[model samples]
Target chain A: MPLVDSVLAQYFEDALKRADAMAPDYALLWQSLQAATYGGKRLRPALVLSAYAGLGGPDPAEAAEVAAAFELLHTALVLHDDVIDRDFKRRGVPNLAGAYRSRAAGRGVPLEEAAHRGQSAAVIAGDLALTGAYRLVAASDLPGELRLRLLEELDAAVFASAGGEQLDVEFSLPGRRPSLQEVLQMSRLKTAVYSFEAPLRAGALLAGAAGREVEAVGTAGRYIGTAYQLVDDLLGMFGDEELTGKSNVGDLAEGKCTPLIAYARLCPEWQELAGLLGGTPSAAEVRRARNLLEECGARGYVEDLVECYAARARAVLAEAALPAALLAELDGLLERAVQRSR
Target chain B: MPLVDSVLAQYFEDALKRADAMAPDYALLWQSLQAATYGGKRLRPALVLSAYAGLGGPDPAEAAEVAAAFELLHTALVLHDDVIDRDFKRRGVPNLAGAYRSRAAGRGVPLEEAAHRGQSAAVIAGDLALTGAYRLVAASDLPGELRLRLLEELDAAVFASAGGEQLDVEFSLPGRRPSLQEVLQMSRLKTAVYSFEAPLRAGALLAGAAGREVEAVGTAGRYIGTAYQLVDDLLGMFGDEELTGKSNVGDLAEGKCTPLIAYARLCPEWQELAGLLGGTPSAAEVRRARNLLEECGARGYVEDLVECYAARARAVLAEAALPAALLAELDGLLERAVQRSR
Candidate 1:
């Protein structure tokens, strides 16, 4: 993971330099990207490294490039996601779009105009990062066959994520109410595949692991990733803002149909809870909605689901036939990921 | 060009099939993308095929794939450009985002929300096309080295386009008036490099042309591409709306700081023309602005500039010593490209 971080740092530094040479205005994009990507858990890269090592990959260098590529993919998706969600901030700070919007606002541009300018910049920034991920992989020293295979993996991740995002957006439309099963599938596709399955599988492939072994690791990743996202849904509701750097009620305000929300939709108290979800709920309204979720067992149900998936992940990893060191590393990463307060 | 069109058609058909297998909701994206790309000039592909043939390349199939990749790149950029410019239509038809917007509106979604959803989908659509360009090239049967070279060319195009888009956006901000030289550079970065220079160089490279030959083609492409964009600006302001499928006054309405505007900025009547821009001007106001541009000689000045660039392109092509067939083909393409009303 440390190696991956250094690789990413160097990669972005080179990009920033090239950007500055190209045009100073473009450098702001690189700068904003650097800031947005500063302190993620690096969970994807860790998964890549752990899987690569566990599967007996020869050199860390090749795996590092793949890891960095995933990080760029993550950044690219996050940038675009911000635009989709109309978010100007992430982790309690101004995002790339927010930075541009703030600058425009300071320059006396109208608020709507400023925001549009910012989002437009973010679109181009995402484009650069997305294609830059492929550029990095194409320029890497991997064998041609392996490079193509890895690129195919990347393509699958991108396609699935796009589908999931579209579903998420559509589900939020006025009259659409998806079932709990559909919600779970969307979350798995949106978060699990790219953040977990692809990175883990890529690492194993780099290690030249057998097909069976790769599939096994991906299965484990699927469980772990689902559990991770389910926990994220919980955190969005109840986590400490100081630690999570996100408003606990913001998801409710946005009317995001998380698994808990889906569970609530199936419950008797849903009529009252729905009233508090889609608008700017007062603090009292938020508290009452939280209590209703608890009273209706939606909160408990989602928590139990997370633990269930986590247990399944552990069971799969135990039987995966990975090396002892890697297995222990995976266990630690999984525990920290799903059990975290933030 | 025909081969490239067929290649693109088949590519989209296969992609649509895959999307259907993935999820029914995802199919609309592919459908919209296919429609958006259905009937372009296919200029980029022509350059690639021409260079490949003129340079004695053994296969048109390989060049077709490369040409199709460029078309995808063009579509991808146009998709994002629509989002940036807040345009729902292109060439008088609804774009990908517009298609999505229309669907949402038909479903009774609020206008603003529908527009947002449409733009978000366009962002994702652009992402797919941009990466799909690289994927197509990577999956081609060309030698790995050449494949890598082509991918690098694509990277260069994307980067330059992003920079150019940022500059264009920034230049449009209130109080920023750039010189004609700066406007030319922006237009070149936004259009010429990707549309002309890269494709020409790529074709020559695909044919195993010498380094000097590749560079020469790129040089000729730069001149021709600049001329083409200059002609496009003229069409935007003066061409028949029926023939061009765009409003002649739309550029003025948006206050796009084109080369013609830069020329007007240097003239005394600039103030009068400026007043008619950046807003929804009435027909009479638009007519007055056009007359002012003509009366101040900005229109004539831009026309002369176009001819100058066209002549430079001809001179460069003549001295490049390309094969007779390719030379003649390029000449024909250049004339049609620059002199067309549409």
Candidate 2:
């Protein structure tokens, strides 16, 4: 883990060595970004390494740049995710954009323009990290063909995510909701593949793993990623805000098309809270929305979905006959991924 | 030109063929995007093909896909440019983001939230186009090494542009302003390299041109691109809305970091007007701001700067000793690039 941290740190120092040459403020932005990633879980990077090591490859150290690439990509997604979701906080603090917004406000910029500037800054920040993700892959010291394939994989994942994102926007519109099955499909396309499948496969591919092993890891990724998102949706409804590093009512306020929301739409009893789903729902309204989710069986439905997918993921890992220790690591991963739901 | 158009059209058809399969609304968004590119100047695509043919390439037809890639890259940059500038119009019409915002507003969505949604949609639209640009290159019929180098060139240009953009934001801050030298550097980094250098060098690179020739084209592109941006900045302040398809007052209202603004910061008489730059200046204030720009000789200063870069670009073209026809074509290109200044 410290090796991962050191690799990321070195990437920042070298990749952004030109930042100071470009401009001091630009350097400051990159410095702040480096700081932001330092204290985080590095989950995506871990997946990349674990998948690499599990597939009978070279040392995990050789996979470091690829791991760093995914971490940067995840950072890009989270930054833009806040812009789309219009949330201001991350990890109980003003996020990257929010920090800039507060800075402008402190400087007496008109509130509207300050907010606009903040969002604009974040967009550029995400763009920087997004392209930096590709640059790292190019710098990965991997074979050229493998590097190209990694880019291709990353592209497919982003393409799927962009599609899912557009669908998400459409579903938020009145009378324009996707079906529950569509929601599940969107969740897989939106979150599962990119969050799980892409990193796992990239790591496997880099290790020169067998096709069967690569395919097996991808299948495992799909199931685990689906479970991960389902649990996340449940947490959005009921998890402690402090624990999740998110507002408990964000999904309700943003009208996110989570599986639970999809199921809630099927229940007549949930109609009243549906109006509050995307609006500025108060704490009391969120509590009532929670009750509606409980009464209408949406919560139970989501929990069952999570369990089903988690079980499928476990089954895939067992049948693949990966190292027993690797299987145990994956088991721990699955448990850690879903345990937040409670 | 028609070949380039057909290539782009076919790409949209096939690439987005699966969009409707992903989500109908996703298909609609791509449809809107395709329409958005239809009426543009096609200058970047032209540069790609022109540079290819001028370099003694066997055929311009082979360059079509790469040409289309540049157009998409331009489109991606412009979409985000609107979001950053908070500009509502493009070519005298509601820009892509503005149109979406209008639609949301028409649906009785609250004005502020609708605006936020519109910007969010634009962010995703840009992201889609950005990734689609890379996908086209991967899908190009060019040799592998050439394609890879093209990506490297593109990566550098985008990296420079991002730095320029961040610097642009920093300079727009009230207490922060770039020197005249910094403004010129930012203009080249922000616009010229991406707009002119990358596309031109891409065409030549695809034609198997040599390193010296390729580097010369980049130098020419810098002069031309900076000149083009200077002319554009002037148009933003002084050109007729009917002629430019943009209000003359937009630069003042947006508080852009144009060379003119850079000069105005030096004039004591322009101090009060500078405060009105980024705010909602009234018509009378805009008129006064214009007067101050002229009175303080900032407008003349920018015109001279444009002429300087334009002449420099012509010199680079002549010195490069490309074919006479290529030089003449570049002469025509240079004229076309900055003619709006008159």
User: How many clashing residue pairs, candidate 2?
Assistant: 0
lDDT, residue B239, model 2: 88
Candidate 1 lDDT over A1-342, as tens digits, reads 678878878978988997898677778788877776765778777788878988999778879988888888888999999999999988777888998998888878999999999999899888988887787777788988888888887888888788788878877877788888889988988889999999999989999999888987888888888988988888889888778776898899999989999999988999999889877999899899999999999989998898888899888887878788877887887887777733
Tens-digit per-residue lDDT, A154-175, candidate 2: 8767777777777777677656
- Candidate 2 lDDT score at position A235: 85
lDDT of 1 by residue, B1-342 (tens): 568878888888888997888667778777877877775677788788888889999989879888898989998999999999999988787888888898888888889989999999899888888988888887788888898888878887888888889889888877787889888988989999999999998999999999888988888888888988988898888888888777898898899999999989999998778888888989899889888988999889888888898888888888878888888887887888777733
Candidate 2 is graded, for docking, as medium
How big a share of the true inter-chain contacts is recovered in candidate 2? 0.48
RMSD over all Cα atoms, model 1: 1.7
Q: What CA RMSD would you report for each candidate?
A: 1.7, 2.6
